[model samples]
Target: MDIDDEVVIIGAGICGLATALALHRKGINNVVMERSETLRNTTGAAIGIRQNGWRALDQLGVAETLRRTAILIHRDRTVSLDDGKVHEILMKGEFRCLRRKDLIDTLYDELPSTTVKFGCQLESIKLDPNTSKPVLRFSDGSAILAKVLIGCDGGKSIVADFLNVKPTKKFSFCAVRGLSNYPNGHSFDHDFVRITKDNKFLGIIPIDDHSEDEKKEAVMDVDDEVVIIGAGICGLATALALHKKGIKSVVMERSESLRNTTGSAIGIRQNGWRALDQLGVAETLRHTAIAIQRERIVSLADGKVEEIPMKGETRCLRRKDLIDTLYDALPPATVKFGCQLESIKLDQITTKPVLRFIDGSSIIAKVVIGCDGGKSIVADFLNLKPTKMFSICGVRGLSNYRDGHSFAHEFLRIRKDNKLVGRLPIDEHLVYWFCAHPYVPGDERNWEDPEEIRRSTLDLLSDYPKEIQEMIEITDVKTLSFSHLRYRAPWDLLMGTFCKGTVTIAGDAMHVMGPFLGQGGSAGLEDAIVLARNLAQMGSIHVESRRKVTVQGVEEAFNLYVKQRKMRVIRLSLQTYLTGMLLGASSHLKKLLCIVLLFLLFRNPSGHIDYDCGCL
Candidate 1:
């Protein structure tokens, strides 16, 4: 059987579905092919919603929905673990978190149900070289013809295969996530958390409320409860974007929740803040989040601290608070608590792309977006391999004290040894901290054992001020987490040619970098919005219009996506790496250089940090 349309979409994940919604809003009707028989209830734990993602959601008319479900996070606080000295940084806006499913569901709600054809696995496409129309055949023996096709199928996209496109895996970092109930009256400020210990790192994001009242309140109500991975801040922001879109997401971890461990916090830059604002969660974030005004570097030998005020606006958010806001904004159906993607394969030939599940069922889609994270299937399918640009380690956690205890007001601190430490306020009663150091190969101690990790971390910080030790001592092993840090270069051969025919990639699929600059999810969301707009402007999907839909058009758009993104992503990645390097510097000369650089660059209070959203 054969059908015709103006366009055919190959996946139904975030990018795919968002593209569909965008097209539909533009009055472009098309068939959305999915490999799965039903909408996926479980995706990943959480994702960061930077300005780009929020802009896309705003175009979709669901920014309010997302805001309703997400908690606004706006400030960044960093402090010395030894002296309780603080530095504060302020932001133009903030970010939030939501479960993966919540975001998916919200996007799904905005589309026509009949537009998505499930269980139709793409087998192969016979492109009429003369007209450029694609004849799609599915594993289920279904067929269709379309003037244009969009792969939005994710990093492991068959469309990329058909087009012979591949992405280079820039880095490989596995993450574990979980969620838990926030104790009643917990009163933790709504914020995202980041912490570092020795060279290990962990992050915590608060999600929507877990109870009935939370379930019924506006998605933005701070009561929504959920937690995400203990890794970094990007994933948590992605989750917030989804929830703001009115989808419900839950982050299920292999281990216990971050509340049970120590976590890290990071500063949210304007790039990410724009994402939260576009989603309409910026107001809430601005109210409860902490502002980071400066970053200080202390000389280990002389105990002299040099202060550099932040040039641009930034916020320090508790990781958990960001996650909880996203969780609250989403629909409950959005997330699958314990489900994991074991394996994936593409149908050889099909009008619609098909994904075979390990559960013995198959999913057919117009596209499959792989937000499955760093070790993404979409990235693998595109043949993207991880690159080793920078490798490091980090440790992090939260510490509790009396309500009146005064701590550092700033958000980030670097030592003469180049070790980096930061603190974020979760509430008046608690503070989160993190540490980062250069990776030393062969340092294999079980990091999962909180006790062992804590002992090692404290020993490493022994040279720090006594206040830092006091905080560490008061913080039990149960409140700490650890992990290695790795990053990839922004531009890669694979990302240069990310799309083939109807398939394309987004998020970590195209570019994966270190989390220091916090633009990972921000970039992905930008990709989604740009791709959606391009597809919307392409018009109908019918065979008659196929000739008018030139390969040049698709190529041009894809190229533009890459060109607009490359420099920005590269700059952010490099900035993050530089921050890490400066923190981990070993030599006196290097430390002095860092100080000089800080004074030269960061000393200016009027300096501006610009990030282009590529909306133009």
Candidate 2:
């Protein structure tokens, strides 16, 4: 476990090996550790390298070798997959499709003997107290101390944790690339082709003639029967529900990992618990958070308090726990991380939904479910108008008191001067709280940092109880977040269509409402259960007949899902809208209107949480 190396690299992919080689040329000793038994060639069959890439290869002394075996691309074409529109552009610079194995092999061959240590998996990294150097611990229980560490370990790198780097933002699309052989000469010109429609894209590049006239291409795979976009709570839950019914689905998430920890916590009531129970993760998740017994409403003006008993099972869970539990319940490889959806369109021949990703890859699915959130690209494909934002914004975070506090296990809400502050205990030592207020023009100028947010929140509550002030002041800044609330208009949900062909939407993509009702998370869970139930019934029919899911059959199922969910979501949206109006209304007339509507439509405020989404 003792080493004299000055630098260490954790990966032997193209980047890791290339970095080590660069360091070697600079007279720096470095070791590249690869967990794989050999170099990876599964990335793709070939890569299209342009002029800059060739220059980089030249610096590494591999350009000439690659040039000898790669075909030059001279022309470029952009084709619209939707409308059959084609535009051809003349090529200018150097571009070629070299086999990825060729490049990887060349890099590996050029490296010094024994430079890469295979089968070394990095388990943990900590700083040496004496030398201030990084001490890397491998899974084999060996440790190495190095002066510097470089992470070229692909996207989900463990080394990233050592640097405290924020996770990369997830996009809405992913890619697929492969090598296709054409023993018979292909008619394609010595040019590259870029095909696209909406957010979808495809690229085709030819390899050298000596390589069996092979071409690197990105095309849609027609084998995917069910494709769910997003790996959030709704997406994973839906996938799990389907899996429970013997229906397999691919959950495509743009993020490299599970749900973002920044979502803080989510309150799951009876309906959400029902959905989780049906998904087979409820029992395990229940131990993560304590259940609520009652809701305590406090009025700041008169120090008055009112309590309402919480009826059914209700618990506040760390969003990470819920997402992790749901994900862990499913079979391996069921969720495909980094598969961001770019565009989706109906195939002219089969009429099935074809989804394209930003990574130049695509897949055709018999049924496409959009569990993507408020800014859903799938909803856009359905031509649904975007959700509207409210003038009110919420600042939320977690407050931890290491020394256990003596607070009741109750959901507390306090209101004064049109501003509302709410707090609920996550456990004996942790609490989740939120402050919502009207949007003041340029007020965010003071809320830039966590300290600033804390300061502003404290100032806003200066006249309130001292306990509240102390809680806000001592909150951990990393958990602080502020954003405006947005919701789909109630009217839109009533009259708008939620299904097109065999594609449909769920969760926030379907019915996004304000937090007034606290039903957003539960509603999405309900969506997963209901949607899976309908699909299971439909899939059972197909299984009995030994036939594939037809477009008409899928469409019928989606229509039924919409039919069952439409009015319920509309009612939920309307209630949240009215509640927001009651709090943020600028004039007396609007306030009266909202109050009247609330009383007429919702006789009981907590009635929304009483219903169940049924079993999977």
Candidate 3:
């Protein structure tokens, strides 16, 4: 077959249709091919247009055209069927809800009918070196030549197969969605409303209804018990806790796959052990992790070594293993990958938070735990930002597979000229190490590259002991990590209690001191256990009063949790920050002062280490 079109779109789904429409407006002729019979086949589905989506549509010059026929959604509602509790939230930014067919029809009407060829399924593709164009063979004994073949076809795309591009598969949660016909008027004030019952949700949006058809609304039957915003350590831990309590929560991770900030290991301290024990993973971790009763510190200037018996309870566990253990406890389908949080709106009635994903999906949780991270968007919901205020920066990573480290599992620290290198054995095959340096004005954003970081760290610790230097040279570049390691002071927590309505932050999102004391990961576990306890308590509460009273109880519990964590986190955060200062001490006087302070602090360990939130 001979084709004249310069561009051929492989699919006529939303992406293909939109691209074709944009090309049409640009006076660039393009053909859209669809295997589907008709656009109206998408009749029952309603698509949400968030602020970002609206902006993209505006650039495509279709925003006004679509908005004229779309329903503006500003208010959202969630009702718990367990009791008759209803929660209302005020939505922000521009939101529109319209039927999928209506959107397709509008985009289709913008183009000439012949622009899209229906029933033309793509069979195979051949790329020609001369034109560098794609030669497409269709299932209907027809062929087309395209200057540019854009595969907008979803997963299982034939074009993708031709290019040998594997489609990324994600576990999709089950949803039963269809049009709920209301021949009579369905009375509702808000444009968007979602009603949820035991493990099932019914989301309905009033139709834009340009036609005289009697159908009044669209219904989305989504079966989900909870929506967790982040898939990091705390997010996974909280999911496990909820799982143990018979409460199912789906973790929403922005990344296509798991990102191990815990690339290698975490210091599971006494507090971490307590929280893990409550979650029932303590024994497993203990078997895997090395108990750290003391740390060996070496001074390169004098070639002297001293061992310090650490007071705070500490254990070094592989970062990946800890996260995997927590994540494994829950059902596999409970986490949704590639679902990044775009924005969050507060539900005024229940004070619960409404989460909006980058994909335009909105979720209302009975409670939303913000375990996103140090630069948490959920933390921003509290009107704060992570201040990059630490004077010391560190690069950390685990060595590639080896037979095993020869020594015991105790931590090793070597210091010279304000630069320090610390190593802890992660397993027989892998050892975790961190290289630290004093903050230099020029050292901004240099840690982005693994090789560059490794080299720079080598330069910083040039005069260190031979074995420590060999560790840096021989370590695999893939496992290395460098970060500013931020922390929040009291001012960042704000004047009001940390818990606002149904939103609360945990892990590095709430407090981010350096890993000097190795308590960063441990502190996060504490947050997870405490928050889960409060939320589970709310779930267990018998609703004698359904509406306002339930809100009060939830809010009171959140406040108490914040109050309980305040003193504990503040003390640890300060100590961890101080430890960073001690690690970077260069002058003789400063070193002496650090040694004395550390000795005293080690002798009189704070009661914080022994404290435990009574087991769930």
Candidate 4:
């Protein structure tokens, strides 16, 4: 086919579309020639639309529409990496980091529907001898004779070649940019920041408020160096641990917001306290709970009592407090909530782990850490066996004494017929209590209702002391929860692989164990500290064209993490397993063996709490 146009713009990118739109506004008929079958979508990251840029958009009658999509930049700051110096200037006019897609889509929508011609790859161009017009020949064996040829065809323009223009120069360094979305809002000032070291540069511009829906759309195919798959204590702590070492990571959480906030509390022994201190949150969290001075053990069957002095710092913290503290300590956009991971596979080209979410969005990460609990998708990707369940389930809740109870700063454990219930004060007015008992045949159905869980727990513990019963009765129904105790076998941790390529597991995902020894949360925190330490030792992380830590570097860091944490967690897991076994054992021989093993392995039950994970 042959066509004739008064004005033809090559390329359908921002320049070509804007040009076409300008010509359309002046009532000058024009057409745009796009080589690909569809508009360019993934060619660029973000464009800093400055004052003149907005003015051009205003002239084209589209500035007002684009203004609503992004935040305004109030200041521009330049950071020099050589001497660690900084220069600042207040922006005189409007500035923003406008997404390329937003601009391209806006321009395309403003133009006439028939203005763009897709699948039109230009082959050559020549001057028509008779009319002196430019003749455009396409690879599809078609031609167009236009009075004017505007070459907006990006870097390699055929029209520019025909005009004998100087070719574009190639540079040694490349630039790649992306937008980081903060669903809960960002803490950065409305500034456009540029950090430069020699020829390398990084730009950070504040965009508009990112909502949940927009966050899901904006990070569809983004790439990150490190991606932590859960936002719980372990995941967020790991991110913060890395952040403490000046490393950035993306935390993908499945929930809409922070979860497990009911009434569950984590006992932070000396080890967990050491990890929190390394993450720089220990001082703040310590004021939230009272310190335990001693422990009390009571036998309901024989009315036998025992007391032991606590050797180190120990406190019970609400799970919500820990989660919120860790989350608030991280930078903006570090954690992306509502991101349900669908599956994970290694990319064929880069061998990096590619995470696919249920929303059809995916991310390619240089390092993937599975902190998504025992049933982690990343662990499944690593082909680790699913965590096995114990014969018991645990029910936990928080009780409030309006008048402030008269209990001392002590942990009390009462046991009878394989049923154990413990209570510890979080503060003067709130008490954290839990019960671990044999799993009933139909206890799974009670998981959805807190009332049923409370009732079942009360029924199971009916033979306990009256004060314990009263504490359970005063507990808030909303804080009641029933969960099956699940753990990865100690032998599995010894023989099975916890890491493959640049992927590894942490927290409950790597070593979930019974809470009898009170090491699950602490062990996870330790995992965070140790993992971050190993990774930071590789080298400084830079957001340049490529990551500093290559595939081999990631593997080496993960191997070190697993190697350091393997025996430590194996010992912890084995102790917790034997504790559960001793409580649930039916035969006298089995019980005796568990007792003998516990005596042999850990002469001091609280000795594990003394080990420190070291500084970040």
Candidate 5:
């Protein structure tokens, strides 16, 4: 089957099918290779195709089929279980939920059989250097060369690997859904209700095919809610995600007030951008956020600054802004600021845990999520030990860019001796910087006091550039923070387990490592979305059915979450550690060579961007 000159598409999922349809509409023929004998039905679950997707379908002349076959959800209802408050939202444009199979079938029927090849899996991919075209090799030992190659093979894509852009796959959450035949209209006819619970989120929609006369019965004797520990970014994001799905959760922060002193700024790459955009949290922060353009690495030994080609939708924003952005998104009562965790007791029979707060109040939780920091109690409860420490420590600070500043909207990195320092401009008036260096064996006072942290920071950065030293001096003396850089080995997460029973961990609780790649916060944000999605699917029963959410359901979700996320986090942990080592090289000549090699290898930072998190 060796062929030449055609648009070759791998995988027949939504993206592939849509691309095929779009191309066909323009009178362009394409060859689609599907690994399976039949089209995938998105695991037999109903999924919502928003207005933008509907518009794409319209362009392909299949919008009518979709509208007729799917349920038209004109209105959406969100319920808060904590306060029992109902908020009605008017959806604009075409919003519908349909069986994934039905949508796939509609698109497939429009295409000619000659255009699609089933049971043809991609084994390897190559590009012709002379012709500059993509060459594909299939599992059946056949080959084809295409003018253009589109890899829509989902997470584990061979074509993506060929392009050197294969994503590190992870499932931070789980989703279990079922389709119900409702012959008659119920209370939620023509409407979609998103209900929040204690342990899970239930998204119930009324399908168009209702029976003429159906008796309405009460549904839900099931315990579906969650108990969230640690009201930090991860916890708040998780709470908001659950709330959006109309799931109930009690967010308990250990401190009496919102936690502060977050150590300056943080970076959110394309992955974080897409997640925040999908979660409806990115729009407002755009004004205050700085779009990072290039990464400037400085050789402190000779003061040679090299600018690497770094681009894409990378953003640097204040830590306070990120915390406030996530924290304020939730309803006022969603987070109980002063609710500290004193004791956790799990019932052996039900697997439900009773949480005792320091104030003497207690709540029994069916599912508990630990979003606490590196020293996570939930991790200990689940038998996940603290990450083994590396011989490095990290110090970070934020400075007031009171007037006009020199380094705004850039990610500047400096390497001197065995120390690595970075300055990222978060906004016009603020800058965030961090130093990762060899840890001192005996001196531990810097970990406690901010003044000592400043002194230790100065000692480490003895003869840095003037701007770098001045930024450290201008930092708020109270806000300087230090921590031991520790990481769970890749195998530790791959084989060492993350959850037990209904108790699990999210974000830093599950994978705590050094912040070398600046993806810890982004991953945490993504965790909120993934974990909420999986928990929501566990409660996707028909409104008229009496199916109690079980502990087994929660465990199934946790299993999928761990399985999906383990490898991705492990890859990120190793990349971050290796990057820290390269940048913290003690030998000047070795550092110069590594920087040159790194610039050549990772110059296009776009390849390192986080884009795959939103699809799940």
Candidate 6:
């Protein structure tokens, strides 16, 4: 096989496609081989596109298209799904919500049609035993030779397999997702919504047309729409942020769609907001979100109801509306409808990554970002392990009543066993409720079964006030969702070695954390942005040494990438772990201590951490 190009890409997911576009921008037209028979569309809905992600999209010339379909949410409000009470928090500036399809379609459109080959599954790599150049063989018996290959294939990648890279299983967390149609007369207060019970978290997102009805009609658009995400809030928020940056995205869920469950009302702290603002989607979000002036904390056991004025600003927005806005902002091709990543491989000799599909096909790419989540295949391929922290389990849902609901509020009703319940108001029509309980590791309780989890949650909260108990009694089990909390260690040798040749990891693959600090998706987007920038800046000559183009430059660049991202990711992972520990404090004394410490340190000044990387 004769080498014909400078680079070859495997897979066509966000990472692969984004890398292709980046290379294209650098005047490099690489071949993108996808194993699927067609573009994938079934991977599920919405992902967070942070400021960093937005910057990359902007640089790729898809920002404006994304903005047109996305909803910019400046605020997040937490409300009691049971009591209709609200607690509002302001995000500095961040756009939330874009459908997965919208984002993929947009990226696809940017590439020259000739660059992508659909249904070209990689069978094996034929290395030039003498020269070491890589030859990629396809299932169809055709082959192409390339100087450099990138494994953008996901976890379980064949590219990684060929290179003999094995990823370690960190934690066992599986996610189920579903989408709901927009309801009539829905009052959406924030762009993103979150409800936490013990160790579980549920996120709701709003999706809508950015243009007014009349304008949409004038533009011959379809009816306004929104998506409800039942996964962890961080994942949902990441998708939302991407839309805020003007990248369209969509989410397809595995479970039955819950059409009647209204979107969530959650608050966004300063840390999340600042990241959004830097991404250039903050202005639009501010227009529709509610700013929080104070946070009211109510503890039933202590009879302590304190109204603490918010030091730094916080905002609230309706979750569904945010998703709708993000969807509207993105180009149609940005997301695929049902593409699931089954397996992946990283090929070092040929230097291109490959992905093996469940359907018996494959795709190859330059880089693979593991935003596929905690039990990520990419993480597994990289041999990264997760360190077990405490496990949390909880139930969440929306309630119909909405009287005396503040936009931003947190009611901590401490019952037996230190169980806590929180309520947030998304709008006048609905509230988001959460109940959390501690659990030991290896507990086999099924959190996804709403009826069972609801019963257990109610049992835990039975000793609370009559009002609280009444709210739980009347809650709808059909609308409820559950989650378990887990954390990955700050540093792992496997992740450090993920980039053997042309393969790398990102998002949850590198670090999966509990949703304590709300930085999960934000951090992942940051990774994508940073990696894209580094790859974009490196020239072909710079990527390869003159004397041994195949031997030196590529390895140097890959090594540099690992070094640059390691410290930052490790810092975030540690921060997330510490934050989760503080939030999940089981002892009453510990809770009191934490509350007092928070009041003393977090009241006068914004307690939010800044996200300035100071890197291009």
Per-prediction TM-score: 0.52, 0.67, 0.60, 0.65, 0.59, 0.50
Off by over 4 Å in 6: 1-267, 278-280, 283-289, 305-307, 316-324, 387-389, 402-417, 440-446, 470-479, 491-501, 532-572, 582-608, 613-616
Higher-scoring candidate on lDDT, 2 or 3: 2
As a whole number from 0 to 100, the lDDT of residue 279 in candidate 4 is 90
**Residues 565-593 of candidate 5: C-alpha lDDT, one tens digit per residue:** 77777767666656665655668786677
**For candidate 2, what is the TM-score?**
0.67
- Residue-by-residue lDDT tens digits, candidate 1, 20-51: 98899999887789886557546576776866
Task: Give the count of colliding residue pairs in each prediction.
Answer: 168, 5, 2, 1, 23, 152
Clashing pairs in model 2?
Answer: 172-340, 172-341, 173-340, 174-359, 175-359
What is the per-residue lDDT of model 2 for residues 278-331, given as tens digits with 9 covering 90 to 100? 888888988888999999999988889999999788888877678878888888
Pick by TM-score: 2 or 6, better one: 2
Q: What TM-score does prediction 5 earn?
A: 0.59
What ranking of all candidate models by lDDT puts the best one first?
4, 2, 5, 3, 1, 6
Off by over 4 Å in 2: 1-216, 441-449, 539-548
Candidate 4 residue spans exceeding 4 A from truth = 1-224, 260-263, 539-548
In order, what lDDT does every prediction score? 0.58, 0.82, 0.72, 0.85, 0.75, 0.57
Which candidate ranks first by lDDT, i.e. highest? 4
Which has the better lDDT: candidate 1, or candidate 2? Answer: 2
